[model samples]
Structure formats: structure tokens, C-alpha cells
Target: MGGAPERADGCGARVRGRSAGSGRLSVTARTRGWRDRAAAELAAAALATREETVGDVLVVGDRTGVLARALGDRGAAVHRWGRRLGEGEVVSAWPPDGTVVLSAVRLPRSRAELAFAVHAAAARTRPGGTIAVYGANDEGIRSADRALAAVAENVTTLRVGGHCRVVAGRRSEAHADGGPDVFAIDFELSADDWGSQRLRGCGGRYRTWPGVFGGAGLDAGTRALVRVMAGFDRSPERVLDFGCGWGPLARAARALWPDARVEALDVDALAVRAVAANAPGVEARLGDRVEGAACYDLIVANPPYHDGKEEDTRVIEALFSDGAGALREGGCMVLVVQRRLPVPRLAAARFRRARPLADEGIYRVWELVGPL
Candidate 1:
């Protein structure tokens, strides 16, 4: 919308920390276009003046994350929520109310994600403070508006410069229609039946949550990883499920090697929570990369290549190097990824030997050994 909002001349990338690959650096991309449009449209609104937005503008669920800097440039003390790629600070909890909360939707999200953002925004906004939501017309704005009516008073809509609509409402009640509470985070999930398959666990269903990768169901590549992994022998002393969404691989490792230490790591808080809550004995941690001196005998992952809607290989690129560092000498790493990725080249840089172990349609699994 609005000719794809112009990129800020000084806008650039920022690295939050790092991910799995030992040699790779995972940096957040500077996403422009629709994000800038939403920000610009908000600024142009009568109520979104410097006096209203400055020193207290809070943007949530915005993946592009361009608004924070844009507001900062305008002298507003800005606070942002949600993950930008894999980079973000651990916000112990939601900021208090009495501040303007601007929740904009980016990157297609499940209904659970949208509901959480909306209710979270409402709960964090003081009664009488503003809560503005922006979204593309086709991005379920109408459904959101219907839901917003429950928490806000005198709701109204305005068409913005982009093919977007800004729905402004004042926070009155924290609960929306008494339908669900504000902090309804789906911490425990039963993987949905996508197509014909289910990522079932020995206890029946694997646990997952909203906002986690493959939370809804297993993707094609993960399916391949599970299929290939099932065939491997179960004797590893310790295993790390790198970038584990909800500990599928970690669960698998645990099931196969009942005594092995199965650890799962992910950047998403939701995923971390699910793994901790429903994954039972599996160890779970946050952030994109690994820490600690414990070396893994085997590392399994279905690494993410996209940051939000944009294709970002930096994490994957970094994983090759970082993952190698997490393993002990003679240890091995098993991974599944899209065939187009230069896995062999990246793997060769870290592993002593890297080769494809299986192929399923567009996905490939590689078996790589830690250097001697």
C-alpha cells in the first residue's frame, strides 16, 4: 500500500545476539515498506501527534520494527514489544498502562497470535489511554475490530495512506466481551493434524504453543527431519535440539535414548514456555544461540531461514559455525532444510565431513560430524 513506503535513508540492521551456528552472526533486518507506511499514517493522524506518541509510544507485535526508530527520530521515547526476527530483549513482563499502545500486524499470524496481541495491548493500556491498531484490509482487520469492541469504548476506523486501516479506541475494560482474558498465551499446545500426519509423542501429542515455529503443525522439512531422525540409532549420551520449536526433536531424542540429556533451545518465549511446560524432562532455554560448557553428542534442528516475512539466511549461515562449536569432537549434527540452501558449503566450513543422508521432495537431511 501507498507505493510501498520508502526506506529510511539511515535505517539499517541490528544484531540482537546470535543463534546456533558457531561461525554465523544472526542480525535483524531493517524491514521497510508496509511497516513504514503504518508508522507514517499514524504520525499523520490527528491524535498521533508528538504530544500523544512522544515519550510513551509503545508498538507491539510489529515484526518490521521500523516504527520504534521512526518514532525515536521524532523525539518520542519509544518502547516496542514482540520479536524482530530472532533479536529482542527479554521483557520480563508487559509495560504498565497509561501509555499509548500501537499494535500493528505484520507477517501473517494465526488467530491466537492476533488475539494475544490485541488483548495484551488492551490490558497494558490504562483506562482512557489510547490503543491504536493498524493492519492491511485483508489481514483480518474486520475480525480484529469486532474483537476490539469488547475492550475499548467508542471504537472508530480511518483509512490510512497505505492499503491499511487504523482502528482507534480508548481502553476501558481489560477483558474483551469476557470471551478470554488479556494474557491468554497458549503455553500448552497439541500439534494440529495438518494434512494426514501428526507429530505425536509417546504420551500421545507433542506440546507446542502460539508464536512458536511449527506451532500449528509440522512443516514439510520438519516432517523430513522426523522421518530421517526416526531411522537413526538411539545411543547419544547428550543431544541438543537447536532452534527447537516445541522440542519435537528433543522429544524424539529423549524417546530414543531414554537416559540421554535432551535439551531444547529457541528464541521465541512462547516456544520456550511450551517446551518447559509440556516437554516434561527436556531442558529448555531462550535466545537464538547456545551457551554453557556442556558439549552435545548430537545436535538436531529444523533451522529457520526467514526473519518474519523476509528471507534471512544469516542465522542459517551462522548456524554452521556456531553449531559446530556446540558439539564435542567426533560428535555429529543432523539437520533438515530446504534443498536450495548451500548446506554442504556451510557445513564443510565447520564439520570435518558433511554429506546428505536423505532426500524427501524439496527437503534434505545432512549428517555432519564435529571436527576431530
Candidate 2:
């Protein structure tokens, strides 16, 4: 659920972690923006008073990437941890003395990760040194504060914008005496699809995993996109469904273009897995990769416009850029998106021409120039 926000710096490139099953998530602007702001605030606070300068710092949680990026920008040594080591790999590979570790998202799903972050912080920071943990109110900031309180009696919370906060505390051996033991919570999920479709969800079958959009069922925008699937030209030989969540578009597109090679690509691994389960014949891939370079005849997508916490058009934009690159000289691309999202402008710039197929205030289908 936690990672970097999209291009506040206009880099256009997005960083993605593993899927929920992997104990990580894609770093979109929604999560990253908050973490970046929080890390900046904490770094400023620590540097504000010259007397508080400790030898090293550590940041724990999913936002470790953001903290690492921010601290590196500020010339501070940084280390990060999460349920999986890859999440912290970028920062961990390059160790810094004034280390900053982020433990903001859910505590590590594994004890090894949790222990690594805690012990690394304690070992790096000198006595009377500062250790800060940041969390969004919705995530687990309150609980993390309680955990930090056990390690550092004087825990102070700094209000960061976007209903997020940065918590600063000092860790010492004494605080470890009565510190809380981290444990995982297990429960069953039961949901009845009260609106529209009736796909009752239970255990692993239900979507609802953290950070997956419309994990419950078809979202309104996605449903709208599905409504227009019947009209798309599916005659191309090699077809790609970008951001193909749960395989609805891929299945329908394949059915319409029976002879076409239909492959679904989604940054969210769960979506890829769902597509595989629901439409076994269709090919599914996790993360953004342009396979068969410049080989696709057509690319279609109902590109995602929102992350869990905010609106990020970057994903959609990147999809178009990558999709266009993969298409043959005369290939075509079709994108369905909300009318207000600025996708049309992006498409116009990237493609030879972008023409509207349908418009319904909230959603519009755009046809871009490709081959035929």
C-alpha cells in the first residue's frame, strides 16, 4: 500500500515494488508523495537543530524508497526495510553513515525484515540519537507510535499534509526492555456483492487486497470501458491489453479477435494472476515490459487513473508511451479513460493522431494512429 508518488519532479518514470502476495506494491504518486513529504519534514526537523545531529538514521516500512531517495537528495546515508528485501535493495545496497530507514507502512510481514530494520537502526544510531517512524493515519501510524513509545518514551508526532504524520522518537536499550512484540493478524474475508454482479467473494477468491484498485469487482470506469469493448476493432493479429485488470478486456478482446494473440499486462501482479485464473487462455504478465519489441499490431487499455490515495495519470501515460513504442509503424492503440484526465493531450503528442470514439463526461474512448 505504500511507495513513492508519481512524478512530482516530472520524471515520468514510476518505481514499482512486488505485488501484495510479494509483500510489496507499485510505487505510485499517491503513496510516494506522502512519504516524500514526511521524510523531508523529518529530515528538516533533525537538521533544524544542530545539537540533535546523530551519527546515523534509519527509515522503516514501504516508504523506505522515498526516504532513501529524499535523504540521498539531501546527502544523508540511508537504509530501508520491508516484508521483502527487494523493497529495500536500492537503498540498502548503498549504505550511508547518517542512515535513514523508513518503517511507515504496515510493519514487515516477516519477522526477519522487522528485526533487520529495528536492529539496524539501534546499531547505527548513537545513544541519544534520533529514530523516526512515519505512517499515514489509515495505515498504522498510531500503532507504530505505540511501538516506538516502548523504545523511546518521548514520542512526538509532526503533522504532514494529506492527513499524514511523521513520528520522531529516541531509541535506547532501556526502551527495548518493555517493547511490544510484533505479531501478524489473520482473519477470513466474507463479502456479498450487494451492487450489480453477484460474484460472492471468499478467502483467496475475493479481490480486496491492499492497494489493488477495484479488487472487489468491476469498477464503474472499468465497467464503462467494458461497455465499449464490443465496438473495438479486434481484427489485428497481435494484440495487447495494457493494464488488463482481472482479464475482462483481454477475454473479450480475444473472443472478438479469435485469431489474434492476446496478451494482458498489468503492473499489479494480482491483476495478472486474476486474468490468468478467469481467462486461462490469455497470457498475463506482471509489471510494465514491452515484450516482442515493436511487434504488436494493436494495443488496447482501460488504463488506471487512480491509485488508492490519489489520482495519478502517470500510469496511463506510461502505458500509452510504451504501447506506442511496441506497436508496428502502422499499428493502432485504443485507450479508454475519463474525459477530464488529460489523456487526450498526452495521446495527441505521442501518436500521429488521436480521435474520439465515444464520450460520456466521465469516460471517453480514443483511437490513435498506428498501421491499419
Query: In model 2, which range of ten residues has the least summed lDDT?
Result: 177-186
Supply the global lDDT for candidate 1: 0.59
Which candidate number maximizes lDDT?
1
What tens digits encode model 1's per-residue C-alpha lDDT throughout 193-306? 222123344444455545667764567777678767667754778888878886667766666677988888765656766677556798776555554332777888898887
Badly placed stretches (over 4 Å) of model 2 are 1-31, 39-133, 136-208, 289-293, 306-311
TM-score per prediction, in order, is 0.73, 0.55
Root-mean-square deviation of candidate 2? 9.6
RMSD of each: 7.8, 9.6
Clashes of each: 11, 19
